[model samples]
Target: MMRSSVRGFSLVELLVSVAILGLLASIAMPVVELTQKRQREANLREALRSIRHAIDAYKDASDHHRIAVDNGASGYPPSLLDLSSGVTDLNSPDGPKLYFIRRIPRDPMNGDISVDAIKSWGLRSFASPYDAPRSGNDVFDVYSTSTEVGLNGIPYSEW
Candidate 1:
């Protein structure tokens, strides 16, 4: 009589493989989460920097008399929308528009909602104190509105 030999994984071996896979997955999950969080943090920083730069540019133009500003105004953009919507150039009588940003960036800490971009950020007017930032008549600075703590143990709003 002729016999053929074949081998298959035993139940014990299969169980051991599944347990190892579970252990590896458990270890990888937190690392993946951390990487994602770090990416968001980087995005947050970039957004903040872009907005701040625009604000500075608007202020510079105002200071240089390139753009007309109110007497009591802080020379900052009246609102975040004003930056994206463009401002009237004082140098041009035909009313040429000077745009600061193409569009306001959404807060990364919060979900990226284009419609609610303005509301998602914590605005700090020039008149408002740094320690207690508040939205006033002007847009001087922007911060994340999220209350979550970052990986560095600092509040997202403070960053």
Candidate 2:
């Protein structure tokens, strides 16, 4: 019988390819994880911005007397629910009228409406108005309570 040439990857070649693929995957996994983490941080940041804007709008209306200051209350809504469901008596010179946010945003991390229960969200009350040191009069700000620093080397609370 005549010798025939075979056209196929050698064992060494196959092994080398698999090794290269494994190395690539190993190198890529962490980068992918980091990217995903960063994206989550960005989402949290955006959510915070939206919530803060809503709070400010409420405050502005209150300050202008367009909306009542919840009667004997020193600040805005005590809880996130207050912003959504709680009613405010707006003394708009017309009379004491009721007003409130149509809805409160769901915490992205917690995937729920109640931030306190989840404990994943941080509160920035009227006293602190910042992420660090949870000391405050009332909840003025909200942030992710996650202590893990992000790929950016910044604390999640700071995000």
lDDT of 1 at 112: 54
Q: How far is candidate 1 from the true structure (C-alpha RMSD, Å)?
A: 1.8
C-alpha lDDT of residue 84 in model 2: 63
**Candidate 2: stretches off by over 4 Å:** 3-7, 86-119, 128-137
lDDT of 2: 0.66
State, as a TM-score between 0 and 1, how close model 2 is to the true structure: 0.71
Residues 4-119, model 2: lDDT tens digits? 78799999999999999999999999999888877777777777787787677667666777654557665665666656654545554555434455555555556555444425
Against the true structure, candidate 1 has what lDDT?
0.91
Show the colliding residue pairs in model 2.
68-90, 124-140, 124-141, 125-138, 125-140
Alpha carbon lDDT at 139, candidate 2 = 60
